[model samples]
Target: MISMRHVVFMNVAEELSFSKASQLLFISQPAISKHIQLLEEQYQTKLFERKGLHIELTTAGKLLYERLQAVKEIEHKTEFDISVLHDAIQAKGNLKLGASTTVALYILPKVLSTFHSQYQQIDISVLNRNSESVKEALLAKQINLGIIEENSKVNQIQYTPFITDKVIAVCSSKSKLLKKKNYSIQDLPHLPIALREVGSGTLAVLKRALAKHKINFAQLNVKVRLGGTEALKNFLLESDSLGFLPKISIAKELKAGELKEVFIDGLALQRQFFFIERKGETSDLNKGFIKMAKSIYNL
Candidate 1:
């Protein structure tokens, strides 16, 4: 077991701010200092030094932090092994998951709700970001596992196909663009449009689809770019602008006559979501959640 003092020191080292570490640990700043002091005394080496108003990890701190990361991997492996010795539903531990906006807002909740009903002792937290951010978070060790719409093919990470998805161009049901039964991809430059921001997997897939016909993404008459799916979806509802969104995101809106899907000749935007983790990792918590998600969605 790791010492509380060491935990405090590691948190402070990771954050480089006592105040931030205190807030993260729900302890006072002075108590954070006391723990760090104890840890430094135990090692007889200063773990941190002030580089300004902010603190920076000293060489000793860096070494200790790297070592602690190794220890953490071992600890999690031990916990995972021990937990599997019993029935999985009876196990107790924390799970951290990162997912892109579509999965977090739509796909994940159903799985989480059902998983929690069976394993009430397990604590769960989710980080919602775009697919690229989710990938970066998993690589940074900020999340134990990630569900992403983009598979970057990085060698250090393993990807398992979760589900297939498609992005369709859509606009408000009342928009004038609907006057035409079907629009060609060539007409996109004339249509006012909203778009998801760069680094978004939705945008990435759309870009690839556009490139198939030798079209450049920059040629579109994009009026605005939003950072999230809901933002772009809402923007389309209020303004009669065209935008591409995941089919899963706007299903209800499409059914309710609030939005209408626009067909583009020869432009197909489709992608597959993947469950990603560190290479060679076989944590039971990660497997259990993946299995649960697949089962919940009947995939």
Candidate 2:
């Protein structure tokens, strides 16, 4: 097990405030300070530098944090492995999972339910964010595994294909644009488009697809940028502005005549969802979950 001092230090590093760390860890502020002070004394060096009201981890502190994270990961793995040895049929442990908004909202629910039914002993927690944030969480050791839509290869991360998702341009069913069965690529720049935020995997795929057709994203008139799939869908429903979204996400809306897919001639937008993890960091529990998800999704 990791030391309490290390745990306090991690919370402080992440929160950047002793008071916040205290609240998060359910401890007193003075105790949090004492733990840090003891850790600094044992290391014989300053772990953090105070910048006015804020504190930043020093170089040594950053190194220590990384080492502690590795230690914690190993410890968790060891506990899980030992548990499995004693109870081969029912693995018992906690799994921290991160997933991008699309995968978290659309893909993971049913799979997670099935996983929970089969392995009720294993506790599962999910962190939902965009693909970029999910990657960051995985790198920071905040999550053991991630499901993301972006396939841009990161050298420090390993990725495997999880599933294929299609993105399509859509507008409110009441929009005048629905009169046309198909639109020319040139019509895209003239339409007011609502797109996902910069870090989104949907936007990444859209940009790549646009670039493939020799069109620049800046050429399109973007009226609004949304942070989530649902928000964009809602925006589309309230206005005539065009938005691109995952086909799976708007299935119910499409069937209900709330949104209609608009096809652009000579344009096909598709991206693959990926199972991502820090390179060389796969654990047995991670593999087990991955196998189960793949079986559930038939990927």
Q: Candidate 2 lDDT, tens digit per residue, 1-299?
A: 88899999999988889999999999999999999999999999999999997899999999998899898889888878988898855777779999999999999999899888877788899999999999999987889999999747899999978889899999999998888898998789998899999899999998998898899889999999999998999999999899999999999999999999998998899999999989998989989889989998787
Candidate 1's error at 117, in angstroms? 1.2
lDDT of 1 by residue, 139-188 (tens): 87778899999736889899989999889999999898899989898888
Measured by TM-score, how close is model 2 to the native structure? 0.94
Report how far off residue 202 is in candidate 1 (Å). Answer: 0.5
What candidate 1 gets wrong by more than 4 Å, as runs, is 26-28
lDDT of 1 at 48: 91
- Number of colliding residue pairs in each model: 0, 0
lDDT of each: 0.88, 0.91
- Winning model by lDDT: 2
